[model samples]
Target: MNPSITGFDYQRVTVAEDVALNVAVGGSGSPIVLLHGFPQTHLMWRHVAADLAADHTVICPDLRGYGASDKPAGTVPDAYAKRTMAADIVALARELGHDRFALAGHDRGALVAIRAGLDHPGAVTHLASLDVLPTLDMWDVLHGVTAAVGFHLFLMAQPPGLPEELIGAAPDAFFGHFLDIWTRDPEAIPAEVRAAYLRACREAVPSIVADYRASAGVDVAHDRADRAAGNQLRMPVTVLQQDWGAALGFDAAGIWRAWAPDLEHRTVSCGHFMAEEAPAETVKALRDLLAR
Candidate 1:
């Protein structure tokens, strides 16, 4: 953790079916839960979580199957469903006395947050997604060479055995590749922090792959059903994404508008890991969104 980011007391709690999560809690005001994306943990939000903790009761949790959280033994399809993971977040918040709270997630965590917003709109006061589209939109928008950039999405989405085996065989390389590639300023993440992330991913390979696999299969079904039922995130929503569309070929705002009616969307120059890559900008966007 960075010395500059302080004031949080870290604790471990179990939510939903004995799933243990490591959470950092601090500050006081409206509750705000932060979720980390793939190849990272609650540590990814170390900088941003500390900032939010200054005004809000910030709760940053390592999503189930990642970080210090318990990785329950299960198959890829069963272990990584966003529905199940979203339940863990809801249960965690409720356990911590927050029936309704603001929620934000980056990368994989963003996908789970989206599910939580869609499935439990009454419980999410506000929602912010960092650098990701809904799983369905992601698959729907992929094209020729543009999609190649996210090859891991397809590879990890494969059935249990092969994907897990390959990742497990070379865990450091697999996880380190993203850590190295996703940041414009790699030195921003200290050696200890980078090692921690790599270790977590190395140990939780099956569950991680299952998560992506579920996004490709069952998770998409859930999102489509929510859309078919005319469900839009009723809460004020904000999205910060790298300019994938401009760089690739789709409209980022246009796609998000389809799901959130009251959305404030922006494109930043940072890489996929916006929170760490652009903490000041991320903090500003978060403050502005929560204020609205």
Candidate 2:
């Protein structure tokens, strides 16, 4: 545990087969698990987690392939599927003795949270997604010049070796692009923290690519199946998005409502990285979700 970041007790725990996660736990109330996005670790929730910890027992862990978590080789295209990743969260919470808990995720993690709520509706008490739409909706909505904004999504969706090779060749520049572009305030992330995120991403290229590849493939199938089966998030869900649909050409809240029956969707001013860019609003949203 680094003393520089106070309030949380950090430890590494093996949560699955050959998967050990670096988890941070703090405060003393109901458990609220926070899942991080791509090119980022649990550290992305540093501010929000600390604030939530004051009233709720906050649990933040790097998703399977990112941060200090175990990066097992040969993760199949289906392995990075959101369903499997969501199961990991359930197992981690169970391992830590929480049978039911509030769940929140950002970006890639938000996709995982959606899967968890749908697959194991009984486990997740409340759900919060920051700055993302369902995988299928995201792909469906992309077209023309506006689609260029997420060029990396299409690039990283390619087959294993080539995409990994290209990204690995210049990892810092690749990861730094998002770190620099995704935030409304780049200064929100200190140099040391930014470098740390880039370094972690650089070392976990294969797993990271596999994660995105799943979204392009198996994850879409999973979402389609859920929709076919009339599955929706049973828990109360709160979504904070950047109003991409208005800027693009769809209804952001409308699309989210298709997946979540009980939804409270808000479009905020922050960039893609809302948790970091708008900590106070993010914290307040989480608190409201917890209350629901």
- Per TM-score, the best of the predicted structures is 2
How many angstroms is residue 292 displaced in model 2 relative to the true structure, after the best TM-score fit?
Answer: 1.6
What lDDT would each prediction earn against the true structure? 0.87, 0.88
Q: For residue 260, what is the lDDT in candidate 2?
A: 88
Task: Tell me how many clashing residue pairs each candidate has.
Answer: 0, 0
Question: Could you give me the TM-score of model 1 versus the true structure?
Answer: 0.96
Question: On residues 1-292, what C-alpha lDDT tens digit does candidate 1 reach at each position?
Answer: 4232367887788886667888888899999999999899888888898788878999998888888788876653546689889889999899889999999999999999999998899899989999999988999888888888899999987767899998899999999999888888887788988888888898889878877888889998998898899888889999999877788888989999999999999889878888888989999988998899
The C-alpha RMSD in Å for every predicted model, in order, reads 1.8, 1.4
Query: Model 1 scores what on Cα lDDT?
Result: 0.87
Candidate 2 residue spans exceeding 4 A from truth: 1-4
Candidate 2 lowest-lDDT run of ten:
1-10
Clash pairs detected, candidate 1: none
Model 2 lDDT tens row, 164-272: 9999999999999988888889888888788788888988999998899899999999999888998899889999999677989999999999988899998899788
Worst 10 residues of 1 by lDDT: 1-10
Q: Report lDDT (Cα) of residue 135, candidate 1.
A: 89
Error of 1 at 39 (Å): 0.7
